[model samples]
Target: MTTAIVPDPEAIRPELAQPGSALPVPPQGLRASRNAGFTSLRVGVTALWLSVIVLLPLAAIAWQAAGGGWQAFWLAVTSHAAVQSFQVTLSISVVVTILDVVFGLATAWVLVRDNFIGKGLIDAVIDLPFALPTIVTSLVMLALYGKNSPVHIHLQHTPPGVGMALAFVTLPLVVRAVQPVLLEIDRDVEEAAASLGASGPKVFATIVLPSLGPSLFTGAGLAFSRCVAEFGSVVTIGGAVPGKTEVSSQWIRSLIENDDRTGAAAMSIVLLSISFAVLVLLRIVGGRAAKREEKAA
Candidate 1:
């Protein structure tokens, strides 16, 4: 009979035989295969989770939005009050986004670069909206800015009040998004550009803005999407004044209260559509900016 020989794993992997480093080591191919399997499993789990939480709910809404057919959906969305709500929601959301971008950037810059008394308190306070309930925020707004206030400034039942409430809720989104990016920015590059005779605005426009493009878009998109469906804060302040300060969420509620489920679904669909469209637009804009960055590199 012929003698049989088998290769030892320790011999195959010399590092495994090293003193104080003696450990079983899988072959490179096996390790790679295991990693690939784990990656696939993780991908599948993520898809399933998102489907259960986000996709399924969105599909249900879209299905309900079409419950009465396209004609009914169109009528529901185009009615006078519905159109007014759309206008108010869109206009306020746009203003909120612009304000968030400008102020969010400034707030993030100060928080990252400047140091002073109460700075830590200000940092924590920026996230207060995230912890506070939206209804409580509205209530606070009513107490401080509503009628019967010591300040004597009433904003209840007004569009600007609604806008202000939205801004308050969304401020943190932009700040948190931009703050990390601000910290990661290379000040040496800015100093280099300045040394090369680049003016302040020129340095910011060239060096700072490009790096911040994606983060700004992310923050703005989140703020816009969240504010679109914001119910508690806006509803309390705007008073659901139809064709005046009424927003999409309030309009949808009114529809449901009036036994118009289909109309409410249709209105909800409109808000979803607007949010989705804006996200897509931002994605495209950001992608193009990234390509430009690659080319510049």
Candidate 2:
């Protein structure tokens, strides 16, 4: 058996190690050390911030909810008022989510595909809800659609009023989510499908809808979540009408105001559970969408 020998590169290229040659400024080890330090610092700061701002508060709410024991918690969450609030919230949120998904998609399409006068203003106005205070938003809705002579529309102090208010605040979530996805979609595919005798709707349903499924789910889910906890918007327009329009958040606030901390905590825990469920569903749907895209690709 014979073995091959490796050549000494330094011996063959003496100029490679000549003096006064430039080297890395801080050396690799020192650079790595600094990078590691910076990474550790960033992680530490992020963990600390999340712990103090988010995790700790959620843990505290859980602890408070647990203090009332299982039976009391159940009663608090299942009492007629609580059940009514949940029903009202869930029902209206369903309607609101449907409306948001439909109109939001239309709005996104127009914003991306249409060129019209004041398009820039319309686009900027889409974010107005995000910047405006919820109370202010409520007031604006009430003025337009409330019991008045201007529009001859009276949705004030009703479930429809509450739904309109929520739709106003949450429409932006759906629009923004779908807008970016729309911008990234390839128009050539749509054009090619149309040229292939696929009608406009057919092309959109087959070629576009699949790509937008995840974003629609994301935007609709977020809008529904926001609808669940909406307070100020409904407070004035919906008026916590118990079995009619009182949302989960309004009910919780009423509980707190009536000095029922245990009940408040219980209701809060229920809302948290609902949010967690939405999060889980979003994760499952998002994962399935990713797998489908991978398979298609």
Computed on alpha carbons, the lDDT of every model, listed in order, comes to 0.90, 0.91
Give model 2 RMSD, 1 decimal: 7.6
Residue-wise C-alpha lDDT for candidate 2, range 119-222, written one tens digit per residue? 99999999999999999988888788777728888888788999999999999999999999999999999998899899988998998988898999999999
Angstrom error of the Cα, residue 272, model 2: value is: 1.4
Question: Per-prediction TM-score, please?
Answer: 0.85, 0.89
Clashes of each: 0, 0
Query: In model 1, which runs have C-alpha deviations exceeding 4 angstroms?
Result: 1-36, 196-199, 294-297
Candidate 1 lDDT, 116-227, residue by residue in tens: 9999999999999999999998888888778786788888888888988999999899999999999999999999999999999999999999899899989999999988
Clashing pairs in 1: none
